[model samples]
Target: MSGGVVTRGRERRDQQNGQNSKTIEQKRDEEQVQHAEANSLALTMRSGLEAISKEIRDLKTEMKKDLTTLKEQVTEDVKSEINDLKREMYQQLSANTKTLQAQGSRIAEAEGRIAETETWNMEVKDALCKSLKQQQMLQDKLTDIEGRSRRNNIRIFGIPEDKEGDSAPKYLHQLLTTELSLPPNVNLQIQRAHRALAQKPNINSPPRSMIVHFLEFTVKEMVLKKAWQKKIVVEGRPLIFDHDYATEVVQKRKAYNGIKKLLKEKGIRFQTPLTKMRIPGTTDRSSTDPHKKQHAMPWQRVGERREGTARSAKEKLQEFERITQDSE
Candidate 1:
C-alpha cells in the first residue's frame, strides 16, 4: 500500500508541474499578440497626423493667394479713382480761366470807348468856341459898315407927307432956306431928299420921317446943329432932327434909358455925344463943338467929382486874376 501511495503522489506532482508550464506558455503567446496590435495602432495614428498637417499647409497657401489677389484689385481701383478726380479738376480750372479772360477783354474795350468819347467831347467844345468868336467878329464888321453909310445923312422927323410929286427935293430945299433960317445968298448944296419907303397911313397918324442927303459931311452936321438950335416948326408941329444911325447903334444907346429918364425928371440937359450915351455930370466930351462927329468918343475927361471913383492898378490886376477863378 505504501508503494502504491507513493507512486500516485509522484504522478500527481508531475501533473501539476506540467499544467503550470502550459499556462506560462499561453500567457507569453497573449503578450506577443498585444504587442503586435499596439504597433499597428501607432502606425495608423502617425499616418492620420501626417494627412492633417498636409491639409493645413494647403489651406494656408490658398488663403495667401486670395489675399494677394484682393490687395492688387484694391490698388487698381484706388489708382483709377485718383485719375478721374485729377481730370475733373483740370477741366474746371480751364473753364474758370476762360471766363476770366473774356471778362478782362470786355473791360479793356469799355475803357477804350470811354476815352474816345472824352476826346470827342473836348474837340466839340473847342469848335463851338471858335464858331462863337467868328460870329462876334462878323457882327462888329457889319455894325461898322452900317454906321459908315449913314455918316453924311440926317433924319428929319415931324415932316408931313404930301403929293409934291417930282418936286420933293425942290420942296425940301426951299423949306430948309425958309424954315431953317439959312442965308438965301448961301448956295446950300443938297444931294437928294426923300420920304421913308412905306405905304400911306391914315391922315391922323404921325408923319413919315424925311431922309436928307447933303453934298458935304460937314454941311450935314451943320444943318442938324442949326435945326436942333432953331427948333423949327411945320404945320403947327415942332420938327426934330437927328443923326442917321444904324439900328444896332440905336439899340446900344438904349443902355442910357435909366440915365435919360433920371435927367429928364431932374430937368438936366443931356446929350448923346456919339455911339455911346453919357451923363453930363460924370464925364464931358473933349471936343470944342459938341455936334462934331470927328471929335466924338476919342477923348473923355471925367470931372472932379469922378476923380475918386477911378480904380487902382492893383485893384484891376486883382479883378483880372479873379476872372479865371470865378469862371472855374
Candidate 2:
C-alpha cells in the first residue's frame, strides 16, 4: 500500500511540471512577435522623418535662387530709369540755353535800331523848326507888302447899294465933294471905286461897304482927316469913312477895341498907327526906333519879336552853313 501510493503521487507531480513548461514556452513565443512588430513601426517612422527633412531643404534652396534673380532684375530696372531721366534733363537744358541766346541777340539788335531812330528823330525836329521859322518870315513879308498896297485906299460904310453910277470913280468923286463940303475946284482924284465883293443885299439889309482907291496917299489922308473932324450925312443916311488897311492889320487892330473904348470913355486922346498906340505925352514910340526904350504895346512887341526871329533864323542858317563847310 505504501509503495503504490508513492508511485501515484510521483506521476501526479510530473504531470503538473510538464504543463507549466509548455505554458512558459508559449509566452516566450508571443513576446518575440511583439518585439518584431515594435521594430518595424520604429523603422517606418524614421524613414518618413528623413523624407520630410529632404523636401524642406530643397524648397529653401529654390526660394533663395528666385529671390536673388528678382533682386538683380529690380536693380537693373532702376538703373535704366535713372539713365533715361538724366538724358531727358540734359536735352531740356540744352534747348533752354539756345532760346536764351536767341533772345539776347534780338534784344541787342533792337537797342541798335532804337538808337538810330532817336538820332533820326532829332534831325527831323531840327529841320521842322527851321521850316516853320522860314514860313513865318515869308508871311511877315507878304503882310507888309499887302499893307503898303492898301495905304491909299479908303472904306466907306452906310452908303446905299448901287449909289455909284456906271462910272464909279466919277460918281464917288462928286459924292465926296458934295458930302464933305469941299471947295468946288478941289478935285478929289479918285483912281477907282467899287462896292465890297459880296452878294447884293436885300432892301431891308444894310448896304455893302464901298472901297475907293485914291491917286495919292496925301489926298487920302486929307479926306480921312476931314471925315474924322465932322460928321458926314448923304441923302438921309450918315456915312463913315476909314482907311482900308490890309486884312492882317485889321485883325490886329481889332484886338485893341476894348482898350480903345475905355480910352474914349475916359476922354483920353490916343492914336493907333498900325498895331502901336501912341499917347501924346506918354513914352510910347514906334517899334522901328532902336535907340529909344518905348512903352511897347502887346501887338507891337509881337511884331518886333517876329522880325527878330526872322533875322535870327537867317543868322542861324548862315551859321549852319559855316559849320558844314568847316566840317567838310
After TM-score superposition, the amount by which residue 72's alpha carbon in candidate 1 deviates from its true location, in angstroms, is 29
- In model 2, which runs have C-alpha deviations exceeding 4 angstroms? 1-96, 201-205, 235-237, 279-328
Please estimate how well model 1 matches the true structure, expressed as its whole-model Cα lDDT.
0.74
Tens digits of per-residue lDDT, candidate 2, 209-280, equal 899998999999999998888887776889998888788777878887888899999999999888667888
Task: Candidate 1: give the clashing pairs.
Answer: none
| Total colliding residue pairs, candidate 1 | 0
Per-prediction tally of clashes:
0, 0
Give per-residue lDDT, candidate 1, residue 197. Answer: 78
Worst 10 residues of 1 by lDDT: 301-310
Residues 1-328, candidate 1: write the lDDT tens digits.
9999999999998898888888888888888888877888888888888888888888888888888898999999988989888888889888988988998998899889889766544444444444455787798789889878888888888877784367777877888888888888856677888887777778999988888888888888788888878978778888889887888777766776777899899998877765665556776543333475632122232232222223333344468689979998
- Report lDDT per candidate: 0.74, 0.80
Could you say which candidate leads in TM-score?
A: 2
Q: So what's the TM-score on candidate 2?
A: 0.60
Error of 2 at 27 (Å): 23
